[model samples]
Target: MDAPPTEAEVRDRLPAGAAPFAGRRTELAALATAAARTVPGRGRLVVLAGRPGSGRTSLAVQYARSVAADHPDGLLFARMSAPDGSPVPPGRAARRLLEQLDAVPAGLLPADPAAEDPACAALRTALAGRKLLVLLDEVREGAQLLPLLTEEPGCLVLATTAGPLTGIDAIDPVILGGLDQGAAVDLLGELIGGTRISCDPVGAADLAEACTSRPAALRLVAGRLRADARASVTDAAAELAPAVPAAAPQAPKSRGATKPRGRGPAADRRQARELLPAEPVPVADTDPLVAAFGLVYRSLPAPAARMLRMLTLAPTQTADLRTASALVGCPAPEAGTVLEKLAALELLEREPAAADGTERYRVPGRLYPRLVELRSEQDRPAEVELARARLLERLVRLVDSARLLLDRTAGGNPDPLPGPLRLRTPAQAAGWLAEERDQLLDAVRDAIGQGDLDGSAGRLVTALLRALPLTGAAAPADLYQLHELVLRVAERQQAPRRAAAALLNLGDLQAAEGHWPQAEEQYRAALDRARAAGDEPACARALEGTAGCHRALGDPVRAADWYGRALALRQSLGEPRAEARLLVRTAEAHTAQRRFDEAGREYRAAVAVLRRLGEEEAAAALSQALERLRRLVDGEGIVQVSE
Candidate 1:
């Protein structure tokens, strides 16, 4: 499963190492004082609220790390919302938290809805009296934090939100305004060097003011300065001056009042107009952080600039070189250079490189909105849609390529993509699928949501669904949702074959969850769609699903009948593996009906097929079952179903 990043991963995203956090002393002291004053019964909730890029998350992480020893149990972190600004369902959030605490196994699915939330219950029990610190970042609302809150006074809850988390009880909010000038300059000094700031203290102060004392804005300015060693603070400030709002024009003298100035108001107004930028900047454009973003954006070369605009359409939260390359229709080497340049400019945050040495980058949460706005303002609708289409097509081919390499049942070699994307081995293929699981899900959403009713979206989603087991990346509920999404897309496209495949996938999930009736309903629906499409393989799959559901529901006769039909279909299709699997199912159904002789015959047939297919392990297992069945029949002993 793609669990939330561990504490170490979260720390990597924080402003640590070379980019030291230089401000928030008062806030840290406040948190420390609060910890010192903790009462016995109830816990303390300190919410760090601020605008995007105001350093709320960084401060929280810094404070948590400083006091790690105080919470010997653990310091856990959970993002209350996804990077795409969607609130994570509380149940899912609870599961992630519990996994972090090692209270539940990773990738464990939730209990049945009819039962209580075992995940949340287990979390509460596990955290009942521990001296733990929970950092909840990107919290969207007060209610979103409730499920994750604990009542122990020994525990400390530090939550970060874009705005005030109102209506929560006993809440202590540390609203993070812009940094003080000294602190902002200190941050600049840290980025560059104190010697540079000492040389032109006035310019450093002016630059801080121009950046509105926002840490993120300062970082951008500092990044630019560091990249060009000869660039001074004054130079950076002047470059950003156009984005800063000019002082409001003095009100015109009243009609009755006489002008006593040396130069008339008209001349002054004309001169001021000439001094202003040719293009009018919006109110939001006046924001220092936004201005800094614009400054960095305008400095980009044409290809990098266009790639920045199209990056908002990237389905993944963090993009690797392949995704970046596909977004701009560029080669991998060119895309890598562009990505590194953006990272240097602080336009994107560079994540640790993947094990395969693929460079990854993300549009910082605070910067993403501005990037999206730029896409809307600079790129035409057609251009944006083309980028979106290219990205989706790239994702489809990559996923299909990975699936082909992983699942032998998925016949045919992957085509279209060049050598780099053709995942060579099963391990490599599965790892790629797992790493990009969420991105794949988001791509499916994008594919369908973009009004592609021509079955392309369904095909993309189906490709991912077929590879779900090999990846084992998604939780059962998430997989179920994706299947439903694919089903809807298939139905809208009037693609019966795709719809049947989606239905069978849904049926398998339901059966795994022990919902026999629901599983049967999905299987029956799939059977109808398969018949309508005259898709024999899909029909066989649906038959197999229905047979399993019937067997689960204790209808052995129906199970045996359906299994026989599915087995016949597989045999006719020359699918030896599928035939062997159905034979085993048929043997189980016969054993359930107390037909020991028939069960032994079916087991023997399955063993022969397994051995012919070089499946030694399966053949040996089935051979043992066949011998056991013979002994049971000869001695008139009890017939037990195979494990």
Candidate 2:
């Protein structure tokens, strides 16, 4: 809270034999200059992009040290670990920064960033006036981290990342590159006592070339050289390779920053493998992010390989023990063990306890892109299907639970009732529905692809219709663009039952909005299809659609006739809820015609049906209708009888 243990502590704590922060003096200077821009009225964003171990951390750390004096208020270090081998996700990073700033308590972050943003915004408010140096490191998801940086003029934000954060270009970019040959050689000499290396020019150049000039690699090679009194520059250069796969797999680490046991000899023959690089890694050769990741991941053991792929199929970017276990066909404990190994190897990262007191793990940013590529190639249709099934099942249960807040009851069958479902009030429910709009649609689209039109098309039409009137939301561009997707599936699959049901709902929607002519077309078409399929229930709904449109257009006579037909059909089909609603509508039509006696009789029947179903809301409305008719027919009749 009181200015994160000063830069002095960090400097003193640097690992023994770590390079003397050399070769990147200019770049570090540039970062310092950027950090200085935070002058109480203007804020600065400095993004340092480079591959892992390209010394971005060293430069950023050194810059933090240099700027420490400028920001006496506080200097906060939140390792949103792209290099700490753990990918600190935006929410976790934000929470970490909040914790470091003493803004939010450690356990208050929400399970998801969507919910965590408000907490982060609160943190920003708390930090807004402070002169702080905040470093956001290893940003895999830039969008998530941007909100955490205080925009206050007093705070300096220096973010270290794998590449440009596409959405956040507001910051100046400093891409850290490996040192040039001379700088590399000079720095290696400094580490191993420059005098010894420079004493033999050719040997020093060879050593620098072999070191790939990357500070980490340089320090490593120098550590090995200094330890071996008999080792020559040529021998050390030969020991450090032109291409030591940036991957640091867990070999029993040797003492004092030793190079891998076999890496030096591998580099001595680098000229033979001209394609190999001598530097820390050019951030080239791996054309895409996946390629770079592939170079790192492809070397893992087969079980680890499968585990990595399974994690990619996780529902969210983060995975809990259960999710990992299911995906890997292992138990939770076994999954956690495997996850532990992945984290230890720096292939995965764990999030801090979220607001829910639950945590999840994920692949680091440095490894995710390659995992994505490997996953695409390795993900069989079967595996994807399995994940898809689990997700869809979960979604359906959630949606069903949501509907319970509407007071919808279970049917009369003896099936167990769903668990008590809680949701926000109607207004909040609508908002939530809006937020989940895309994910819900995505699920339906996938279901349609799987040839399940009844569920996909039906739920989609129901959701869109229900949400639209409440939300008045401008339909998403993609929603309208792909609205016809499920319709097409219904059409192609020859499921007239589903097709007619879809048409009836669409037509009913059109009719409700005063589009009578279009409504008539869809309803008539739907009616014909329903009749063709012997779907009496669907046919009745289609007729009801027609009657509602006609009634809205000032044709009570036609509405009455259509309502009668639907009522008879529903009675024949023995469907009580439909019969009750139609009966109530018919009674209103009779009242429209001033046939008070017939309207009273019909309304009484509706009240009986609603009462039996325990629909208090509907039964009350029916009782009101019957009393209105009684008032018209017999003025002396009591509208409310005294007991």
Model number with the top TM-score: 1
lDDT of 1 at 630: 70
- How does candidate 2 fare on TM-score? 0.45
**CA deviation > 4 Å runs, candidate 2:** 1-284, 287-299, 352-359, 364-366, 372-533, 542-565, 589-643
How close is every model to the real structure, measured as TM-score? 0.73, 0.45
Write out the backbone clash pairs for model 2: 109-355, 189-194, 212-278, 212-279, 239-264, 241-267, 242-277, 242-278
* Candidate closest to the true structure, highest lDDT: 1
> Native-vs-model 1 lDDT?
0.74
Angstrom error of the Cα, residue 243, model 2: value is: 5.3
C-alpha lDDT (0 to 100) for residue 397 of candidate 2: 44
- In model 1, pairs of residues that clash are none
- Regions more than 4 Å wrong, model 1: 1-18, 34-45, 70-76, 82-84, 91-133, 150-157, 228-231, 235-279, 282-285, 400-430, 453-463, 466-468, 471-474, 527-643
Note the Cα lDDT for every prediction shown.
0.74, 0.59
How far residue 83's Cα lies from its native spot in candidate 2, in Å, is 21
